[model samples]
Target: MRKPVLTIFYQYNPWQSTIGGIQSLINTFIKFAPDTFSIRLVGTGADNGQVVGQWHESELLGRPIQFFPLFTLLDDNVRKLVPTTVRYTAALLSKTLQSDFMHFHRIEPTLAARGWLGDKTLFVHNDIPQQMSSAKGAKTILWQQFPQLYFWLERQLMEQFDQVLSCNSASTKFYQQNYPSMVNRIMDVRNAVDTSCFKPLAPGPYQQAKQQLLDRLRLKPSTRLLLFAGRLHPQKDPLLLLRALAATPPESDIHLLVAGDGDLKSEVEQAIEQHNISSRVTLLGAVPKEEMVTLYQVSDVFVLSSRYEGLPIAMLESLACGTPVVTTDCGQGPSLLTSESGLVVSQREPQSLAQALVTVVDNPQRFTPEACMQAVSPHSAQHVVEPIYNSMLQRWHVSQANS
Candidate 1:
């Protein structure tokens, strides 16, 4: 039998170094997939005019995977402006044509490549339709305006795929009910974490790291640290964290670390000022991947104030590192959270979050490091993700034979 060639499509390239769940998931699949298949990562790259080489190649953990840049400039004349989308149409199509299977990590890129993807697959990182349905304020109004068009697009894009793998249980169920014709094609899998890298630190080192972070921030030794790490988007709801922080008691000895950046960053800053909690927050924008473990180790608890999520990797990473999570009832993250692992707010309100944060912050022993690590141990990448990849490869073979 010939070795299968699989290509994965995502909006951001692995080289971007942006803190995002989809990018992390693509890289994780590449690193953890069995060595039977040759993989290529396809994404839009922005290299303004500093093109060192046409094609970039490297190995992850000594395993090789090729990257085909959909939109990077080859000309030195173009300064820092992103070149036209028209220039990369041919490149994207050619890359898709040459692969045995093309996997998309988001719906936009999949819709962009509609009608021509051979042996196509789509991964649902977040449920867009569900988001629209449950959203408040402007989203509800906009969704109402184009409800028919939105549903039509959802149907049009999903019908052509050979398989659909979802990390969100709610998303899987949503597809199953609306598109009963394709229900057999969808498989639900947990978002994975590599336990080896994300596990907890020893006691002495943990305390040293905690104290160092507190000292660097000029916070007292008795301060309780809370970490909120993810893209500062509406889905992650960075502003909600600020509101929760404000709602905490006036004398609460706690500080929050915001570790990612996005469109909501300016709004987050505004909210912090409006809530009068500027002194209690630190914005650590776009943290390096190497330092993530240390970030989790120093915190008393990990916080997810998202409006919605598919099982966030950062939440899993937090738990794996012995840092319990306090989250809204967003998605799969809450399923893993227990009283011992963490707490989930009854609603997505500032007061609810504040109460939960105070509860966890005041009683650390009730949610110990060991219990947190034990809660997420079963979702290890090797155990949860490798089989999904293997099954995907098998499904690709079956699809091709039938075609």
Candidate 2:
């Protein structure tokens, strides 16, 4: 049988920013997508104004991948407005019309190309309008001032997609309540982890791994390791984690390992200095994805103090590594966590987060590594991807028969 063509549309290049959850999902999809499908990735390359309207061939998952650089044709003004959805849609329409199935990782492109999206699937990673409202500075003011217009436009664009795949229950519920007519189109396809790579180490290997990390960082074995991985941005609220760390007892031998960098790096550093917890924290800025599993294995607990999220991959990765998480109730954290794997604080305040961290660290046995690993089995890459791929193929077949 001839393979169906699957065209994926995303705004940014995963190769360029390999740090985010969205990028990880796109990479995972490309890595594990069935061989029966011919894959093409449509995204923006570096805006060097050199590679626009070009098709570049590469290998992903041992299969051929054709990449279309749509942003090369976009001018600076248009690129600035790319976040608005309409501009990139126009760019993608000409290139994406030939695929058997179209999958979009971002909403703006999906909204722009709605007319040609009869077989398209829109993957909702976050609440769009809410994110806009929560955005910093002038953008937030604009979104707040014209809430109805923004939501109306968003609803119209979302309704056009044949299938809407949400990564969390919170997003599914938001769309169902806001757009009742389109409830049937929404499907919950949660985020997943690679269990094979992130599985817990045996006692001997685990102890050695912990010791190696401690030796490298020059910390004693008795010192507890707390990890915070991801962007050091306002949305991630890295400062809150710093405050919480400062609030922990000064005598406690707790140390924090920060593994990512962003625009908020200077601010985070300033706050670290302000809090006088510099000695207790080390910034191992922007570690590679392969190293993340090792960090998780060595750590006592992973912490995320985000203001909002859809479903963070770091939380899932930590659980898969059999390391418990202590996070604020954000995104799908509340839905994915249980007493066995992690603790979820109700408030985003430093005091609440600190208390939860101290409690989890003090009684590490309460959340067993084996239980943490087991809880994430359902969210393995194989389990999540197979069903979604099958469903997409089935939908494509139905659409073809009707046409």
| Among all candidates shown, the one with the greatest lDDT | 2
TM-score of each: 0.88, 0.88
Instruction: Compose the digit string of candidate 1's lDDT tens values, residues 317-373.
Output: 899899988998877788888789999996889999999999998898799988998
lDDT of each: 0.77, 0.78
lDDT of 1: 0.77
In candidate 2, stretches whose alpha carbon ends up further than 4 angstroms from where it belongs are 46-52, 61-63, 72-98, 127-146
- Residue-level lDDT of model 2, residues 1-403, one tens digit each, is 4678888877556445345677678877888888877888887666544376787787754667888777743222121433424546778666535567888876656655666634778888765544555443233223456777867777668776778888877778888888788889887887878776777888999899889989998988898999999877666788899999999997778999998876678989999999999989999887777788899988899999987777888888899999999988767777778887889989878899999888888888898898788778788999998888998788768777887
Model 1, residue 271: C-alpha shift (Å): 1.9
Spell out the clash pairs found in candidate 2.
Answer: none
Q: What are the runs in model 1 whose C-alpha is more than 4 Å off?
A: 46-55, 72-98, 112-118, 137-145, 396-403
Each model's number of backbone clashes?
A: 0, 0
